[model samples]
Target: MAGSENSKCRGLRWALIGSVTLNLLVAGVIVGGFVAHDRHPPRPVVGDVSLGAFTEALSPEDRDALRRAAQKRVGDFRDMRQAARTDMTALIAALQADPWNRAEVEQILARHKARTIDRVDIGEALIFERLEEMTPEERRAFAERLLKGAQRFDKRLDRDDNRPPRP
Candidate 1:
């Protein structure tokens, strides 16, 4: 009976030792994690959910310069749009001339295609980058289709706009 008692005492001692060791290990990990976090708190990135960092990154002078540059770019784009409108007007006149000029029609189509590609490529790159689930080939095909569709739409509009106004 005493031998059995001794074995029971031994088992209880081992159990207590194991429980204390496990508790210490858990406590140590928690304390270590806290210390590490304090030592290396994450630095905020500019424009990453923190407007303060983004504002801080820009100097007042730089911001002013950026604003001016942005205005200039807008103006340049407006000029391009106006130029396109003028070309379209000339195209309409050429097509309406007593003898339809095939060369003028082709030239107008080419200019429209170039402008359409410029705008479409920007959208294509954005869509390709943002679509997380598409495979590379699928993304490429989608971008191609997008560009073609934009060009076709621009061509159709150009043709319709050039037609004579109803009396």
Candidate 2:
């Protein structure tokens, strides 16, 4: 009987130890997540549109300048975004109509495309203005960074192509 009791006590002790260790491990994970999150705050969305790798290659000052310029025209950006959303909703409705209307769908698509082009034009103008402000040397440096970024992108694409298909 004493041996049985001793074994039961050992089992309980082990279970208690395991529970404490598990709780500590969970606590450690939560703390680590918070620390990691604080280490890298989110990047700001410039003009609510990605300018692609060209924007990525810009110098910090130039990027900030461009961001400020975009902000000044925030109203236009907001309107364009709202129009885009409306267009999508309309397109979906048109797609679901009982009697399909190809002309209506095409009209919505054309409007969407025009809005997209307008947004791109605005972004391009902002970029061009920023470039104009830079000295020749600064522009050359920007070009070099742009080229390097493109090369890196191409290498990544090549690597992805060589990867085996996922199971």
Candidate 3:
């Protein structure tokens, strides 16, 4: 009976040790994640949303110039973003109305689309201006990089197309 009790006690002690070790591991992982997150916060997206791949192809100096230009017009972008948010709120309210107003929803969508176009236009203008300032050689290099980026994008799309649809 004593031997059996000793074995049981040993098992309980091992279980306790295992539980503590697992908790320590989890706590360490959580603390490490927090430290890593603090070290590398997410970067804000600047400039045209549609031109992300094209922007990536740009030289660092050209990219900086575009960023500076975008920053100069930050107020305009901010206003547009705020307007978009307001439009979205209105859209949701329209969707939730007791009597569905199709016309109201359509009008809100049209306004949202117009705002999007305006943002794209600003971004395109910035890109065009930067291109004009670049030397012919730089432009050629940029074109090559842009083509490569496009090819990569196409390949990714192809791979995604072949993937099974999610339930």
Best by TM-score: 2
C-alpha lDDT score of every prediction, in listed order: 0.56, 0.78, 0.78
lDDT of 1 by residue, 130-159 (tens): 344456774566567566666777999999
Stretches of candidate 3 exceeding 4 Å from the true structure: 1-50, 157-167
Model 2, 67-90: lDDT tens digits are 888888888877976776676667
Residues 1-167 of candidate 3 have per-residue lDDT tens digits of 99999999799668645644553565567568667977787555464334677878998888888888888888888898678667766866776788967688779768867987898899899889989999999999999999999999999999999999999
User: In order, what is each prediction's RMSD in angstroms?
Assistant: 36.4, 20.0, 18.7
TM-score of each model, in listed order: 0.32, 0.66, 0.64
Q: Ten-residue segment with the worst summed lDDT in candidate 2?
A: 41-50
Arrange candidates by TM-score, descending: 2, 3, 1
**Candidate 1 has what TM-score?**
0.32
Give candidate 1 misplaced runs (Cα > 4 Å).
Answer: 1-76, 124-167
lDDT score of residue 91 within candidate 1:
64
